[model samples]
Target: MTFATFIKNTTQFLFKAGFIFWLILAILELLMPGFVIYYINMQLWLIVVCCLAVARAFLCKEISPPKADAPMAQK
Candidate 1:
């Protein structure tokens, strides 16, 4: 794959990972009660947001037409 494609895929992976991370963070926040949890929760949220934003940027690229992959078609 080309560099751009690699980056796009990485971003997509990161975005999906962020969803899982967010869920884990929510669960941890619910299960535990402490000042440290609050700090960790805030940091995780920021990282997740950044991941989503970077993935969104990759998805909005105007330089190339959308790729037609079998994985997408399966959905």
Candidate 2:
């Protein structure tokens, strides 16, 4: 496989794992009160910022405009 494909798949897997992590956190928070309010200690804001940055990078990569062809010489 090409390096670009490998990188894309790895990023996709990471995003899936991140989704699962948040799902588990939400479940725990729902099951036990104050789970998010007091128990968690990591820098959630930093993580959120990083996630948004990565997402934006991928978005821009996919949404970039098509390159225009060179114009033909005038007759």
Candidate 3:
């Protein structure tokens, strides 16, 4: 596997896993109310931000227009 492929897969995995993990944490917090659980639940926002950043990075990596200095249009 190439480096690009690995990065792409990893970022996608992170997004999916983070979403699922947040859901699980939310469920646990709801089922068993406590100070610790509430604090842990607060981290869901952090997880969401991280997942969005990962997704943005992956998309940015995949989207790059041709460089202006490389060449000019033939037509």
Candidate 4:
């Protein structure tokens, strides 16, 4: 695979993972009154993870595109 494809796939994976983690935390918080602290901590971590994932998705780029005369190579 190419670098761009790798970045896209990894970013999407991270986003999905983060979303699932946050969802679980939310459900736990709703189900248990004593889980406030856990909820807060999880929320903070989730925010950080989401930010990092977005940054990685936006910032990562392939160094160069394949030239018209060049054969494409898989990463």
Best by TM-score: 3
User: What are the clashing pairs of model 3?
Assistant: none
Candidate 3, number of clashes: 0
- Go through the candidates in order and give the C-alpha RMSD of each one to the true structure: 8.5, 6.4, 6.8, 9.8
Q: Comparing 1 and 3 by lDDT, which wins?
A: 1
Position 28, candidate 1: lDDT: 73
Q: Model 4 off-target regions past 4 Å? A: 56-75
Task: Name the weakest run of 10 consecutive residues (lDDT summed) in model 3.
Answer: 35-44
Clashes per candidate (backbone, < 3 Å) = 0, 0, 0, 0
lDDT of 2: 0.68
What lDDT score belongs to each candidate, Candidate 1 first?
0.71, 0.68, 0.69, 0.74
> TM-scores, in order shown?
0.54, 0.49, 0.54, 0.53
lDDT of 2 by residue, 1-75 (tens): 988777777667666676677667777878987787486643584486468558746743776577898898899
The model with the greatest lDDT is 4
Against the true structure, candidate 2 reaches a TM-score of 0.49
- Model 4 agreement with the true structure over 1-75: per-residue lDDT tens digits: 999778777777777787877788778877986686643677577787879676776766557866687666879
Off by over 4 Å in 1: 35-38, 41-54, 57-75
